[model samples]
Target: MARIAVIGAGTGAMAAAARLAVAGHRVTVYERSGTYGGSLGRYARDGFVFDTGPSLLHLPAVYRDLFVKTGKEPLERCVTLTQVDPASRHLFADGTAVSLPDASRAGVVAALDQALGEGAGTRWAQFLDRAGTAWDRSRRPLLEEPLRDDREVAARDPYPAPRRRRLLRPARQAATLAQIGAWELADPRLAALLDGYALSYGLDPRRAPAAAALLPYMEQTFGSWYVSGGMRELAGALYERCVLRRVEFVFGAEVVRVAEKDGRAAGVELADGTHADADHVVLGAQPGPELVPSQAWDATGTRSAGRAAAPGRFVVMLSLRGAREAGAVHRTVVHCEDGTGEQEAVFGGRIADVPTVTVSRPDDPSTRPDEAHEAVTLTATVAPHGPVDWTDPALRERFADVLTGRAALAVPGLRERILRAEVRTPAETAADTGAAGGSVPAPALAGAGGAFLRPGNRTALPGLYLAGGWSHPGGGPAHAGMSGALVAGLVVEGDGFRGSR
Candidate 1:
């Protein structure tokens, strides 16, 4: 059996380990953080629990597949499912409003019909139906593949070959989500839906992908659910599965570097300066010095030729006295009637306090005390380098000021209900997790080669591979899980969950 050393205990790393171990490889995982569950992981305050990242659970099957493929059943381990609300209420710049739902695309169309009127409903249906189809089409092939084969991806283009030929660069226009967003012209409604799509990326909808306009279809169409006891439970469950499968997890162990011999990964070096051998090394995140051993950050394929998304974040860990009806509790973005207008203001360098707000309620069993408790996270995209003049004191004051304002606008008396609050800045976020520029999630900007420059799963380094939010198929908790599994399949040379036999 080949041996492998998977770095980082995030979902991607965890999933990769499972697949590698089950494939008969002697796998050892090295986590940079003291705890596991990179993004979806959680921490507790005096009797309160806070999920560090991703609150809602979509694409449950991604988690299910990891266990099943590794000879385990996720359903036997975690919460089966709980659906969240489908209606995502949007308050537009022109006072236009609509709510998109999962059960009935009809409701969404109806709302659009009311807002846009007449033929709008038909267009709405046509859009989501195509979106649903897009989701179905990309699920297995793109999500599961290591993305080493770009030619294969191009073949799946929805536009027929002749139409593609007529368009000189049809692939460029639709190869990846970000490219779609950047290429969009001045169509306001499509822009709003695109903005809604980029919400996953914490990006402005105008620059978001038109293809991404399809993401909402899952929650609104498939129904989102809570994992019951925080999505971190998914991590804990995976850890347990690793134990059951005999996959070794070296926790609280920071890998100092990866070792390579004659161009192949020999193993990894720990912070303690100890060496561990492996037959293969799977590296992820916007290729960093630590990710590629024996190579400079700029020299390795994972690093030099990689495409990194933004890593900016604004977050609060609060103990809710009680969560209000709070919409469907799945995925929500409550707006200030002028929400999209407010978002435009933000991008242009103005804070609307509560132009829009999103909250994730984890199913942590002990999240609430005798009173029902839920975890709420509120964030908006900010300048990645952060406000130039946002001094420590100024930023601190601004954060509190912003939170207070957002709470009032989003939920009545929301500021009053907080039992505790912990705020983090971009620099602080990097300090907590060694993310680049506090870039917990990297920017998915398509490089100058149109869309062709976006890094594939395969890097120039022969023995190394990449995964996580920085890797292709990008972002969201579930996407990370699948990314990890994709690397495992490639490293071990398995047939992969993608492609027909």
Candidate 2:
């Protein structure tokens, strides 16, 4: 049996550890923090609980497969998963509001038509049909399998843009989401609906490939789900599953560097000047410059390619005095009025004055001390750590106010109802999760000369692999879990392992 050492307790690393252990390998995980979940962080104060990481989970099938493969208990037995109907409520700049039903194209289209105008439903339905084509074309190469050397297949945009020609003008197809929104949808409100999806992931619609439409398609097709407690509960279940399989974990054990032997990864060195030897190593953290010897990681594909800058989230956690009323939506998105200005500000190293805000209010009573209390979370995409001085108390409060003010659009009297408030910035996120510059990696997209493609799971260094949001398939809980599966498959089945069966 190979002795496998996994660095960091991130979702992907833990997922790989569980599977490898179940496959008869002796696995040990070393995490720098006292907790197991990395970015799946949780905050609690005065009996109020908040999920600082992803509020909702999409594509839960990834985790379901992880549980089934690792143990006899299915995912449902470990955590209660519920589909959130009216998946999300959208507030447009034109003062139109619509709540889209979960995973129902007909319902979403009808809602759009009712809120936006006539013909809106038909146009959106047609667009989704086309988006399905992109989903089919890219799902396998992008999510199901490890990235290969031939970038042509994945690099080529899978989105089938319609060809349109004006009088005396040549026919053209859209390359970006913004272009598709303008040329295809041809409605500013519809354009905002599409752009909201991109901006939510910290991506600029003007540059993100049209293939990005797959994001909405994936959500609407598979459906959005929420755990009984919070996302932390899901992480806890995964951690418990790993422990049940005899996977050893050492928390608060910071890895100083990757130990090397005969030009291969031997194991890891701890910050306390200790070492653990292993035959294979899996990295879950972004390969910082000090992570491994410079020569070791110099030419490795495991190293991040330093892609274009992505925005980080500014979160405001509110503990309200009132009880959450019945029939409260799980998520609400307040879109910006000036989409261009918002995009330019965030992507140009500044936070927008009028940024889009997503407010999450789950009806679970466990999140609060009593039925008379409520827990609300507001998130807005902002410039990453370095670009923004989130450390400044005044600046942080100003941004928190902005988020709360915008969220008030969905939840009336939200500011006055707040009994207490807690703000989390990218700087705190970086400290908690170890993301470089506190920049959350955007979900992978197709285009920009394969710029959006994450580095391959296998690196130039022998016996070393990467598994996490920072690795192959890119960010999001689902993608991170998929990366773990791919890494385990490669380590056990060798380079021939494409993906799980």
Candidate 3:
């Protein structure tokens, strides 16, 4: 059996460890923090709980596959995963509101038509149909399988944008997400809705490829899920599964470097001046040059070398004094008044005057002290820590106030109902995840000359592989799980392993 050394105790790392252990490989995970989950963090105060990271899970099939492969118990037995009905409520800047039904194309189309106009629903449906084509074309290469290095194949944008004729110019198809929204959707609200999806994932809609439509397609088709307690519970379940598989974990053992022997990854050197030898090494953290040697993985022409700066999330957790209103949607998005300004602020390293805010109010008793009290979270996509001073007290307070003001549109008397407020910024994210500039990685897209794709799972180093948000298939809960699966596949089945069937 090969001895495997994993770099972090993040979900991706643990997932790989469990699978490798099940394959009879002795695996040991080294984590810097005293916790298991990386971005899947939680915060509690006065019996109130909040998910400091992703509030919802999309494409849960990834985790389901992980559980099925690792153990006899299915994912449902480990964690109560429920589909959130009326997936989300959108409050437009013009005071128009619509609650879209979960995973129902007809229902979403009808709601959009009734709320916006007679043709709005049809337009959205058509856009989704086209988006489905993109999903079908890119799902295998961009998500299901290992990332291919062929630039021609990776650079191909799978979005089938319809050709549009112009009065003074030649016919052209939409390239960027913004182009698709303005030219094809033909409605400002629809454009804003599309932009919101892109921004939430740290993608700049203005520059993000039209193939990014697959994001909404994936969510609306597969549906959004919520764990019984919080997203952190999902992490706990996975960690438990790893433990059940006999995967050893070493908490607070920070890996400073990947040791090499005869030009192959030999083991890991810890920050405490210790080393653990392994036949294979898997990296589940950000593959920074400091951790992974430059010679092992040259970033010269790879996707890792030229990836754009990703945005970070600013969160405000509210402990309200009153109970949640009956029939309130679990998720509500308050659309920004100025989309252009918000995009500029996020992508251009500044703060917008008014930013789009997503408010989450999970109907779970575990998050609150009692039925008389409620736990609510408000989040916005903003510039990462390098550009914005998330450490400044004034900036944090001001941004929290702005988010609360925007969330007021979704929650009635939000400020008055708040018993306490806790703010989290990119600064906190940097501290928690150790991501440079607290930048959250976006999912890989198959467009923009392969500019949006991430580095492949395999590296120049024979026994070393990359997993997690910063690597192949890119970020998000499901994608990270996929990265772990890919890494395990490579280690267990050799490099010929394509992906899980």
Best by lDDT: 3
Q: Candidate 1 at 442: error in angstroms?
A: 6.4
Model 1: residues >4 Å from true position, as ranges?
91-98, 114-120, 132-141, 149-193, 293-311, 322-330, 335-355, 361-365, 372-375, 385-393, 442-454, 494-501
Q: Note the clash tally of each candidate.
A: 16, 0, 0
**lDDT per prediction?**
0.60, 0.88, 0.91
**TM-score of candidate 3 to 2 decimals:** 0.98
Global lDDT of model 1: 0.60
> What is the per-residue lDDT of model 3 for residues 91-162, given as tens digits with 9 covering 90 to 100?
999999999999999999999999999999999999999999999888888888887657466689999999
Measured by TM-score, the strongest candidate is 3
Q: Write the candidate numbers in order of decreasing lDDT.
A: 3, 2, 1
Would you estimate the TM-scores of all the predictions? 0.80, 0.97, 0.98
Q: lDDT for model 3, on a 0 to 1 scale? A: 0.91
Candidate 1 lDDT tens digits, 89-137: 5544455656665567677677777776665666556656766666666
Count of backbone collisions within predicted model 1: 16
Name model 2 segments beyond 4 Å from true. 293-304
